[model samples]
Target: MKYGSTSAPIQLARGQAMSSVKPWRPDEPAATIHAEGAWLQGAFISKIFYGIIIVLSWQCLSLLWRQTTRSNYKTKMSFLAIVFAIFSFSTLHSGYDMKAIQLGFVENRNFPGGPSAYATLSRSDTPGNIACILMQWLCDALLIWRFVMIYRGCVAPMWLLAATPITVYLGSIVIGILFTIKKLTSGSGVRRT
Candidate 1:
């Protein structure tokens, strides 16, 4: 089966049952119909399921913040912001994926003088993937922070150790964001950086 830019192949998940069905043809509908209706249905259902989980997690964190009085306000606020930022970025990324499918696969592919249905990968279509990348960078930094706190116990040289990784990580983040914006605006879906 094929979706948006029927030229590309749809990579089914592992354990997916393969049908002898041919890929979408130019003469056929822009949106390819697949035999795996159940899987397609489940995909949408999972999106909703995860969305609910995010809301629940947000509520629990908010409640915890309100109930805890022993924690330093700055520390608590900093952690809370990181958590919020990760979730917000992930949600934004999902939204971008949805929009890519709608515009590239469903609508544009069906119309003449329009974009390919599957012309671009969702992540590279625009700067939207930066949300996901930033989330990843933040999570990695948090892990590094935790390690530094445990092993070094906030010793003076600990700052030196943390500084190197932190600096490198931030530099990479800047490069990633710039690369995404450049490729997106240049109308290229692939990134060399």
Candidate 2:
């Protein structure tokens, strides 16, 4: 072994001598693997989100079902139960798609499209993204309804306060529509070598 040889290839930059190569890799992976990379593929986190939504819906329904002693509130209570269940089911459907992508696409093909295909909104999972937006819209509408219930009428202040969220809700819907259109327009990713 040559000790302290000047021919050891020291790098020179801007008339200054520099030694050692800069590291081309991080000290650690960008994301720490949790539950065996489940988080990266979105399977673990999606399941947890679904579980939390289910638990909260179940609790709300339990309370509603137990307290309904009148026919008027009966319809309202049933409506809530239905809406919550529908939204929760929609969320679960998205999670199901995530799991399928993780298993069938990523793991099966050895992550051919990389991890981005598994997590981000792809061509197939567009409906899942729409469902999430719809659910969020419904939740916001329900909150506005709660305020209406409290004010006993659609007063000016209530409407004034609702302007911002309603505008945001509409904006999100427009964005979702635009995204869907863009996705459809950019179809057929198949390539020939």
Candidate 3:
């Protein structure tokens, strides 16, 4: 027989027969969790991780901004702008993800139905993804700019100034690439019934 085919029947003894089924227990919860709940729980954990990263990045930027009295006004303003952009993007992404999770988890059904469900359920179409991409690029640029400013203003060695930007860019690139890969490969997995 072919796989998944159920055409074959079992022979039973003359006295054997199926018994009536019992109702599910009231005290026992459903054995399987909904896909929406699972997705939202994952998103919540991710949001928390990203939130901590944002906080640490902001603190580092703040320290750099405070030490900017020794640098030029233009550089200071540029740094401030970069910091503001990062903060805005982080906040926006976090808020949007939270909303998406809330809608998916609380509603238990995609909004409106049909095509609308795709729009409601997918994070790729959300503003958060775009913001996240932009923020990642901005972070790389800011790191490079900070390194340049430090090198020019304080006569610091190129290697010393390169450290932060190199590390930040690598980290951002890794994160962006991983997220993209996850989005792409997730579709190939077996879907829940």
Candidate 4:
């Protein structure tokens, strides 16, 4: 067998030879296969983490539901609503991700740029992305609300103290909206040709 020089040693400007530093070649089939394997591994890991989160969220939901009664009903109901919203969005996001993964790896495995590239590059999962954005906003707003409630009277010039989170919250909303609009109008986030 002839061992051709498919990968020759590269000489650097610093009088050094790099014979082992392989450059990334996305067009290569081997590289695409490697990327697909890496993406699948990451997806599996995410599923595991999502499973853990589901268990924790279920536990929290049950505890909160058990605590709700006629007394303090209003406050408990508000907390329950926030928690339920978070859970719903998280579930929706996970479901979307799973669907995208299946479509990219199974249904469209021969898509133009390969399955990994198609899965990673496509912004077709806009619903999932938006759900993630909304979930984050909800969590952040909840935190800000808690902060304000705890320090409403303890801090003088409460407005100044609370301004940071409020401003940040609003800024995030604007950014998230802009991002969603851009994604929606950008046409499929991948190239077919």
Top lDDT hit: 4
Clashes in model 4: which pairs?
A: none
Cα-based TM-score, every candidate = 0.56, 0.61, 0.49, 0.75
- For residues 90-109, write the lDDT of model 3, one tens digit per residue: 88888877765555445434
Ranking by TM-score: 4, 2, 1, 3
Q: Could you give candidate 2's per-residue lDDT for residues 119-191 as a string of tens digits? A: 3324555556666666766676677667667776644677777778678777877886887677655655322
The top-ranked prediction according to TM-score is 4
Tell me which of candidates 2 and 3 scores higher on lDDT.
3
Pairs clashing within candidate 3: none
Alpha-carbon lDDT, every model: 0.63, 0.60, 0.63, 0.80
Location of the lowest summed lDDT over 10 successive residues in candidate 1: 6-15
Separately for all candidates shown, the number of backbone clashes (residues 3 or more apart, or on different chains) is: 5, 0, 0, 0
What is candidate 4's TM-score against the reference?
0.75
TM-score (C-alpha) between model 2 and the true structure:
0.61
- Candidate 1 lDDT over 1-193, as tens digits, reads 3357533433443223354554334554434444223434654775795597599658857975986566577777777788888778778777765665456545555544333424443333354577768867887888887878776855568777788778888887888878777656654343212
**Candidate 4 residue-wise lDDT, 107-187, digit = tens:** 777787787667656775779989989998999999999999999888478898899999999999999999999877764
Judged by lDDT against the true structure, how good is candidate 4?
0.80
Judge candidate 2 at residue 79 and give its lDDT: 62
